[model samples]
Target: MTSLSKGDKAPEFHGLNQNNETISLETFKGKKIILYFYPKDNTPGCTAESCNLNDNYQAWLAKGYEVVGVSPDSVASHKKFADKFQFGFNLIADTEKEILQAYGVWGEKSMYGKKYMGVMRTTFVINESGIIEDIFEKVDTKNHTDQIIKALDIK
Candidate 1:
C-alpha cells in the first residue's frame, strides 16, 4: 500500500517502455496522468484492467488524461503483453522496481495464506499540476476505467 494520499505530490519516476523508449513523469507535464501499477504482465486481472483502460482510451484522452500502466516485468514481456492486447497507452517496464518503490506500491502481500513481497495493485490520478488528485487502492479490474472516471469526475 502506498503512503501517498490525495493532494500529495506524485513521486517522480522514469523508466523504459516496451519499445525501450524512455518515459518519465516529466514527459507528461501539464497533463493529467493515470499511473497504475500491476503485479505482472498477461495475468487475468491485469489484462482485464488494462483492456478496460484500452476500451476507454479515447474517452480518457478527450478528458485530458494520459493513462499508463507499470509492472515489474521485462521489456520483452511487456512487449508481448501489449501486442497481444493492443493497448493504446504506454506500459512501463519497471524491471528494477525503482518506479514501483518510488510510488510506494512495492510491498508485502498475502495470497492463499502465503505472505510475500510483491507489487501491490495501485493507481494514482495525478492532475496537470503533478499533484495526486485521487488514489485507487482497491481497484476493480474489469471496471477499472469506470473507477477512474468516477474518481476524477470526468464526464
Candidate 2:
C-alpha cells in the first residue's frame, strides 16, 4: 500500500456528501482538515470515532478546522448515519473508491486470518494549504478527537 506522510500533498478529491451535495478538497481550502477514512458506516468503531468528532466539532471549527469522514458507502447510507448520530460535519460518499485509493487507505486487511482489500481506519491532518501535516494510520476509535487534538497540539 502506498503510504502518505507528513509534508506530502493531500490528493485532490471530490464526491457527494451525506446531503448529496458536492464536496471537494477545494471546499475546505484555507482550513485545517480532518479527513478520516473508515471501514463502513454505522459500524462499532466507526460510530465511536464519528461521535467523538461530533462531540468536539465546535471546538475544531472555532480553531479553523473542518472534519470530514470518508467511506465507500452510498449517499443514502451516509444520510441515515448522520441523521441518526447528528454528526456535525460532512460524510463523503466515496462509492467509487477513488478518494480511498487516492489517499492510500484502500488496501489489504486481515480479519480472522482472512485477508482482503478494504478501507483502512485512517485519518489525515491536512493543513490549510492542502499539505498533509500528520497521518494517523492507527487511530484510537474511542478517543479519536483527543488523538487529533494531541497530534495537532490544539490548545
Candidate 1, residues 11-124: lDDT per residue as tens digits? 999999989999999999999999999998998999999999989999889989899999999989999999999988999999889999999999999999999999999999
Q: List the residue pairs that clash in candidate 1.
A: none
Per-residue error (Å), model 2, residue 50: 0.3
Compare the candidates by lDDT and give the number of the best one: 2
TM-score of every candidate: 0.98, 0.97
Note the Cα lDDT for every prediction shown: 0.92, 0.94
Query: Candidate 2: global Cα-lDDT?
Result: 0.94
CA error at residue 114 for candidate 2, angstroms: 0.7
Query: In candidate 2, which residue ranges exceed 4 Å CA deviation?
Result: none
Distance from true location, Cα of 27 in model 1, Å: 0.2
lDDT of 2 at 115: 100
- Superposed Cα deviation of residue 90, candidate 2 (Å): 0.6
Task: Please write out the lDDT profile of model 2 over residues 35-138, one tens digit for every residue.
Answer: 99998999999999999999999988998889999999999999999999999899999999999999999999999999999998999999999999999988
- Residue 85 of candidate 2: its Cα lDDT? 100
Each model's RMSD to truth, in Å? 0.7, 0.9
